[model samples]
Structures are given as structure tokens and as C-alpha cells.
Target: MSSFVTPKKWLTVPLEDVILRIVGGGTPSKSKPEYYQGEIPWMSVKDMNKHVLQDTVDHISQAAVDNSSTNVIPAEIPIIATRMGLGKIVIADFDSAINQDLKALFLPTEVHRDYFVYWYRSVAQKIERMGTGTTVKGIRLEVLKGLEFALPPLAEQRVIADKLDTLLAQVENTKARLEHISQILKRFRQSVLAAAVSGRLTEGWRSGDNPERNFKNLGEAGVEVKTGPFGSALHKSDYVNGGIPVINPMHISEGTIKPSESMTISHQKYTSLEAWHLRKGDVVVGRRGEMGRASVVESDEPQLCGTGSMILRVGEDALPKYLEIILRSPTAVSYFNSDSVGSTMVNLNQKIIKNFEVYFPSLSEQTEIVRRIDQLFAHADRTEQQVNNALAHVNNLTQSILAKAFRGELTEQWRKDNPALISEENSAEALLERIKAERAAAKPVKKTRKKAPS
Candidate 1:
């Protein structure tokens, strides 16, 4: 067991001594259809991950409980999984029954339930070590009963739980704000890309000699877009271990190449589909999934376009980076959204990509627009990094608060202020003895059956 520094006036004892009862639940027979048709919630380990469970994935009839080993657990009791999902704990928010893997601890009046929940979270790692199994690890009942820990007096436990609850709520609020800021950053980036692709971003540069009439369709500017080979032409079985790299929809993301699962095709397969090959300065667009998502090909070596992607070869009039930005922008994305076909999963093809008109200025103006977009994006990136760091710090603060709260550091001043709650009889050791005595007094004596005629 993990060691803890018990504070003055506090005491450590076996877990069972502080609780009224430790009970295990069981499932109704699966073969009996009538047993599972009622309204009682039957919770498995999956339902125990949340702090409070209002309902379960499955419900069983009351007849199921009468015929099976399962017991109905009242609301407010904390339940922990002793089997497969070891250490996960939650409080029952409604009257419920649990499966065999769960153990419910019925707290005595002196112990606070939420405080125990937080305490269990702190020592969950130790409980995990007590479990034994090769395939599905589980904790034996005796080991669970013998686990030891220190806790503050009742009044102090309430105070500590309240403080931690308030502080943790603030941390969660901060995290929610950070996540909202990240979403705003994404929309801002798309807006910048949209403005860059259209002439609106660099409209200030339109002067006496330069006009906005230079916009042209992608195909009119000598750019050709071609989709990869059709479905029947190349099968997944044709892919080999090491050969020419085949870029798929997974490879194109966020205007960059990020291959989800690296794939290659043999030289013979590559030879048949040489028309769909990719080259340096070529723009690759995802044709099957996530329409309009594009990336620039930076490698000089030969690569083939996989079944769900397309390659765009542009002439000297347009830079590959400039067109790549346009393809990823919301302006191009709007076209893809409207033109994409397929009821379930929308798909893109070369015909739709080639005909899309692109507005542009001279090559020099395009370069300036790219530079301006990059500068603004770099600032946003720095802000996003700071937000992420703040989120990490907030999470770390939660753990630190729990550690201090468990060690009596959080309520150290409270203890000094209220000396009466820290007396000898009110300590955890005395509370344990009272619980044991009550349990013994409440036990029923076994009646001996008289022998029959001998």
C-alpha cells in the first residue's frame, strides 16, 4: 500500500472499519428473457466512469433481483469496479443494481461520501496493484477490505470537499474558455484563407496599371487536375510493403501531408497508373473524403495518387503554394460542398476540381498576399500555444490541490481555527471503533436446529 503522512489528531485504519457494509452485485441470468424487462437500472463497469450515474446502459426487472444474487443499491453510495475496469468509481444517483465486477461501499453517517470519492481517486493506483489476473484483473474482497488510508474528522472532511469542489470548478471553466478560443482561432484562419484566395485581401494594391480583371478559371491557366485510377483498376490487395508511395485522402490535411497509414504499391502496379503520378510543385487534393482539403507535393521523387485523391499540375502562371492555399480556403470549400456527390460519404472528382474559377492578381501580388497571410497565421499560432500551456497548468493544479487536501495541507489553517473538531474521540480511529461496535451489535444470532429422533 502507498504511504501517507497522517496529520496530528487524524488516524489511519482499514477501509472496512469506516464503512457499514461492502457489497457485491450480480447479473440476472441472460437466458431468462423476463428477468431483464423491468425499469431498474443495472450498471456495469462502463457506467461507473462518471462521478455520478443517473441511469445505466441496461435495466433489469425486480423479479431479476429476487431470483439472482444482485442487490439494489440506494442513491448516494459510491461504487467501484473490482474487475476489468479496475479503480473506476462513481456515486449512484438513483436506486440501481450493479454487475458482479462492482463493489458498493455503504458509508456510515460519520463519513462524507464526496470526500471518500476524492480520496479514492487519490489512491486508485494502489487499489489497481491489489488486483490479480492474467487476462481480466480483479481485486479480491479481502484486499479491498484491508486497504488503509487517513482522513480528517467529519467537519474537516466537509470543509475540504467544499473547497476542492469550488477550486476545481474554476479550473474547468478556464479549460472551457481555452477550448472556445481554439475554435475561434480555426474560424479566423479560414477567414484569412478565404480573403487571400479572392482579390479582397490584397485589394489595396489594385492601382492605375493593375486591374482586378486578371482572374481566370484553373483550366484556362493551363492547369490540369486528374483523379486517381478508378476503384476496379487498383485493389487494396495491390498495395506492397516497399515501393512507390501512394498518397491518399489521409495524406492531405491542414494544407500539409500527414499520412495516417503509410502505403505503397509495387512497381508493376505503379507502372499501370503512371498517369496519376505526383510531382514536385504539384497540388494534391483529397477527392473522396474531406473535400477540398489539399497539400503541396514537396518531394522530387515519384509518387502515385491513391484511389481517393487527385493531383493538380499548374503552369508557371500560378505558384503551387498559392493555389494550395486557395484550395484549402472556404471559397473553394464551398464549391466542393455543393458539387460533391454521394449520399453517405461525399466524394470529389477531377471534373469538379478543374472547372472551379480562381481570382488572382499578378505573380508579384500573389507572393505579397501569401506573405501577409503567413505573418497573421504565425501570430495566431503563438497565441494558441499559450492557451494550450495554460490548459495544461490548470490540470496540474487539480492534482496538486488533491494531494494537499489529502495531506491536511489544504485545511491546515481550518484545523488551527477549530480545535474542538480535532479532539481524541472525534478522530478517525474512534469513528472506526464505533462503526465496528454497531455492526457487531446489529448481527443476528444463528439458531441451532434440534436433532431428529435418534
Candidate 2:
């Protein structure tokens, strides 16, 4: 239903005019278990995800088909959802029985199957908007039939469909490669973190005069661990808008503090709970929910830790950034998962955090480790951003190509080169007449009975 101008020599008509018949399907009785346990492929809205369905999740018996309102659609026929999952169209690879929500469109032989499929896809969003319902939205048959369909010459339809197939397939392959690269970047970052914390990253730097690394409890390594204010100490009523911000577990992500402005306390309330205030160089960690969720307080801003978080103040011997890296490493995450308390929701206390053992290297070595990690992470962030942008463009390319095809822009040159094929007997108008004749010939004739009783 887009306002795209019709191409020259193309025929514009109602969608139903080109189709021979439209058949609605039904589900077999669930009471009969034997009806479901069979070899026949039975389709529903759930099975209509892919463009071509090779098989269905559910199957039904032929007896079920005989007894139910469902009909067996021939292979490669287009089926669309009228009820739930509106705007989806698919073709079955085999003869399949459909449930109540789907309708099979029987197109005339004059129409190219792939061409119709692509055309429907271009207008699918328009169809979805016409759907009406309170709970499950659905389109009426009349609404679907009333929509405009632009038809090109049969030969042109084939050319457009062939072009779309090749172009869309290439787009899909590019997306797959980008997605694979994204996963590789994730693994690369994890590997870097693992190496940094285990002394493997700085091993070569220490080869000349290797300094002894000692294993020590976090409390013994000049780190002060403290839990946030409990629910009794800071009530929900204390929170206010445009006040001192509160850093909860959700606010700590990607090794940085992102406090919520709305989840804050007034200056008066903050003064009373000043003991839980966060200072610059402090590490705020999530003590509940996900394990090893920690971030560094990069600024000396007015912020308070929430009930579900803990704070760690590193002494002169330790670097806060380096400690944050160790906490986010795979080894520390594994330890937190195994030792944390509670069943339904995992929780960590000051005692557990203080007793956690970690490698304690010299201050100079910690500085070097933090610098190297920052450089590597910056590179990963840049690469990830580029990949994300490319992915977004690739996603849009599909609809763009589809729009161009429907607008006749994709096959503009073909139209000029093959003018003879689109004229006279080969025109879309001529094709529609043939389709109409085919429909009239396929209709069954009803016999009249003589009145014998009279």
C-alpha cells in the first residue's frame, strides 16, 4: 500500500485478482493422541519463521486431515498467517496440513512464485498495521484482498526474483561473518583479562629481574572491604530526584560507575548516611545478583553505595584499576560463584570479600599491568563499535533492496533492454487475462436435479 508509482507497462490490480483460490486451515482434535502422532507435517504460526519450511515441529495423521477442517497444501505453495504472527509468509517444501491460523494462497501459473513472495514481503509491514484485535491481532481476508499489487511481465518477474535471491544471500553471509567476528572479539578480551591477572602478561617484563609475587588475602594486601548500608539504615522513602546519586549493582557496568539521577537521596538524608559515601579511587562492587560485577569510582563526586553493593578502598600499595581487572577476571568470578552464600539469590559479605586470596605484585608492576590493559581494551572497544555500525547497515540493506525491487528501480535496465518481452502478448495485462481464464476453467460445475416427486 506504499505510494510508489507503478512502472510503465506494468499492471496494477487487487491482490485477490491474481490468485486462483485462498484456502483456510484448521487444527485436528487434541483429544485424539493418534491424530498428532503421525508422519504428516502439521504447520502452525510457530513453524512459519523461515522463508522455506523443510519440516514442521508437529505431525498429524491422514485420518486427522480427513476429519479436520485442515487441507493438505501442495509443495512450494505460499502460506501466510492471518491471526497470530501477522505479516509472516512462508513456503512449505513438502505437502503439509496447516492449523486454523494459516491460509494457503493458490496462485495461477502465470505468476512467478518467488516474485509474489518478495512482493508480499515488501508490503508485509503495511498488512500488519491493518490487523485488528484486543489480545491476538489478525487481518481479515477482505483487507488482504483489497491491497494493491503491482505486476510486471512474467519474464521481468523472474529476473527480479533471481536478482533478489543472489543479493539477499550475500547480505546474509556478510552478517554471519560480522557476527562471528563479534564473538571472536569477546573471546579476545576475556583472554587478555585472564593473562593480565595471572602474571602471565607481565612475565616477560620481569625476566630481567623477576620480583617475587606473593599470594595474600585481600584484607592483608592493604585493601579495606565494607558492605553498604542495610535496608533498615536507608529506607526507600529516603530517595529523591535531582539529589545525591546512588550507585546500585545495575549502575556498575563495563568497569565504570553510572549512577541513576532518580535513585538518589536529599542532602539532609545523605548527611546521615555519610559513612556509606564513595570516594575517588574506590571500587564499587555488586554483592548480590551477578558475581564479579565491579567498577572504579573515577571521580570524587557525591555518590552513595546502595544496599546491594560493597565498597573497597585500596591502600598505597595497590592500584584500584588493577584490582578491578583482577575482580572481573575469570578466576575471581569462578571463586565468587563457588563460595558466595544463599540459594535463590547469591550474596557476598565483607568477610568473604576480605578473605578472597589474590596475587600481590609490586606497585611498579601493577602500574605497567594497568597501562597495558587500558591500551588493549581501548582497541577492542573501537573494533566493536565499528562492527556494530557495519551490522546495523547490513540489517538495513535487506529492506532497502526489497524497497528498490518493489519500486522497479532494481530492474530498470532490464526493462529498457527487454521492451519487446513486456509489450503486446507478453504484457502484465495479458498475463492477468490468462490467469482469470484459468480460474474460470478450474471452477467446478454444479449439476441440477429433476423434480421427480412433482
Candidate 3:
């Protein structure tokens, strides 16, 4: 026996030589009542969203499985999410039926199964590139079967597969930890926003024991509140490429007037209606879909408004930043949504928003409050960034680990320690010989049969 640490043996084989059987999944007819309910797991792409989806969310009766063209994939068959998620692969633990488009792969070659799975996972981008159809994108079975891969020798394959499994395990653990941290950070931000709007955030900044209330209704808070007046005149074609971005309900998010994906209103249109150009410090609140969600205009540069959004121009009496925070508070969000009208497309009209009550402290007090909100929000933003960075790092680590595993590096340490697993000859070749022998021994016996209508 050689004492040369890890084995140096390697080989390459075609995927077509090793692929055992490939099957396409099926879906029972939704219209048939008999196919509606059963113990058998009937899975769709949506069913795979759940992290631990061993059993499916829905089931179809055995009769449905029998009547439908969909075949029942046996246990341990690997199913790939070919349509929606594209490359998301899951090993089915129970007998289940899948949507027709989702490809199911069963490894007949036992030793190569793990290695093939790892290799297939490596080409996620290639798999995504094969996106088909104009509507719901999919990778057809013919396309999937034709996928080419560079396969190493059997002993090397085992080494690579083992290493990849360990590295992926670590990456998955890191990802789980980051996900938990993200949830905690999200909750903290939500809590801070809740406290700010509820008047609890500034609890300590009270007036003296006898100091008269240095406060005014929001109308005196140093800003004017005006809505967009050109609601009826807006059109889709009045949009430009670079000038000012148009604001819509989609742009009017919880706390700010984010620019639309599209730009708007060419110079001619703006010149034709100079009064419609928006200024900074203006708050745009949603008028449809999710009514009353508010956002502030971050840019001093020009912008235009759409029919589905209302532009709130702040007057000199109110602090735009302070008012913007208040609008972002949970209380304000709830208030606007509650006061909103309409069933199909909910909206908070200009009249209701203009008449809405707002509370404010004195100018100096307002400045301090805004400063504190800024500090707290900045802190929250940092925490969020940290969680995001951690998550990103975990994702990168996972890809690296997976890449290293397929490269025959991960199992090097293990192979060095357990030299007994290393054989003098190729392991895959021995396994392949055994399979051929079995097939040769099972030759069909010849039998005489009576001739019919000779």
C-alpha cells in the first residue's frame, strides 16, 4: 500500500453514460372533483417555498393520479423546480406527483448520484439561461437532458462529493444564523418606528413643570400642505427619459417618494405646465391600491406626479423632515389607511388628507426631535446593513464551498486520514463491472410458443 496521503487517481465520463432514468412530472386536472383530495402529496412550485417541504401542502386522490397523465414519482426521486424557481432542486421523500413542467431525475448509478447532483447544482446560471416561453418561463425536459457536464473519475467524484457536502453544511448554518439576525434587526426597526409615532420616543423632552405648552396645531408648524392639482391632465406619453421622474402609487412607499422605474414629462410638457413641477420637501402619499402610505420627496430636482398619487407640498410653517417622520409613524399609517375610502382601489383623497390633524412641538423642540429621529434611524440602518452584509457573506461562502467541493479539494483531508477507502484500482470501474455482470447474468430464457393462425 502506498503512503502518499490522498489518492491521485482521476477520470472523466460523459453524463449520458451515467444518467440512469429521467422522468417528467404531471399535474392532475384541477376541474375534476375526484382529483381534488387524497393522501398522496401533490406538489407545485409554491409548495417548494417552505424550507422543510418533505410532505406537500396539498394532495390529490389516488383516482386523480390514476386518471391524470401525471406519473407518481417514487420516494427519493429528485425533483427540480423547472418553471418558477428554475434551478431549485428538492429530493422527494414520499411518493408525490409534480407539475408537468418540473423535471424529475432518478440516479440509477448509486455512486455517481451525489456527484451528479453537485455538478448540476454548479451550473445554476446555465440552467437559468435555458429559460423558455414568452409567458411562464420553463426548461423543457429535452433541454435538461441535453445539458453537458465535465465529470471526473469515480474515486475523485466521491472525494469531491464528500467535500462539497461538508462545505455546504457550513454555509447553510451560516445562512441560518444571518437570517435569524436579520429578523431581529427588522423587529427592532419596526419597534423604533412604532415608538416614534406614538409620542413615546420623545417622552423625556418635556416642558418644565410649569412651562406653558409651547405647542401648536400642525397648521402652525412652519409648512404649507397642498395637493397636486393636475390630477386629470396626466397621460402616459407625457414621460421623458432624464428630466424629472414621475411619481406614482408604486413610488409612494411607507416613508418616502421613491422615483418610479420610468422617467417622466419632457421639457416641452414641463414648459407647457410649469405649475406641475414638484419641489423637494414635498410628501407624496398613495391615492390608490394601498391608500394613504406616505413618502417625502428626497431630491430638490424636478419631478412630475401621476393620477394615482397626491403630492403634498409643505408650507413654511411646518418642518418637512419632522412631518415626514410623523407620517411614517405607525399611528399615521394606520390613521390614513383607516380614513381611506373605496373598496376595489382604496384611496386617501386630497380633501381628507388636507383636513387631517397633525401635532407639533415648538420649533426648537421640533429640531431636536428630528435630530433624535435621524440618529435612531441611522443606527437602525446600520444594523440592517450589518445583517445584510452577513447574509451576503454567507451566500458567497456557500457558492465557494460548493465550487471547491466539485473541484476535488474538500475530500483531500478525509482521504489522507482514511487511506483504506482508497483502492489500487478505480472504484467506479469496479462498480460498473458489477452492474454489467448482473445484466449479463439476467438474460431472458428462450421458450417455445404455439403459432397463431399459421
Q: By lDDT, who's the top model here? A: 2
Each candidate: how many clashes?
0, 0, 16
Predicted structure 3, TM vs. truth: 0.79
TM-score of each: 0.85, 0.79, 0.79
Q: All models: lDDT?
A: 0.82, 0.90, 0.65
lDDT of 3 by residue, 299-348 (tens): 87777766666666666555667677666666566767777788766666
Which candidate, 1 or 2, has the higher TM-score?
1
RMSD of each: 3.5, 4.4, 5.1
Q: Rate residue 330 of model 3 by lDDT.
A: 63
Candidate 2's TM-score reads 0.79
lDDT of 2 by residue, 1-454 (tens): 5476768788788998988899989989999999998999999999988999999999999999999999999999999999988889999989999998999999999899999999998888888899999999999999999888888899999999999999999999999999999999888877888888788888888778875556788889878888999968999889899999988899988787788889999988888998999989889999999877899898877999899999998999999998898888887788888889999988998788788888778888889999999999899999999999999999999889998998889899999999999988999889989989998987778889878995
Residue pairs with colliding backbones in model 2 are: none
Q: How would you encode candidate 1's per-residue C-alpha lDDT over 116-190 as one tens digit per residue?
A: 888887777777887899999999888888877665788888988898889778877988999999999999999
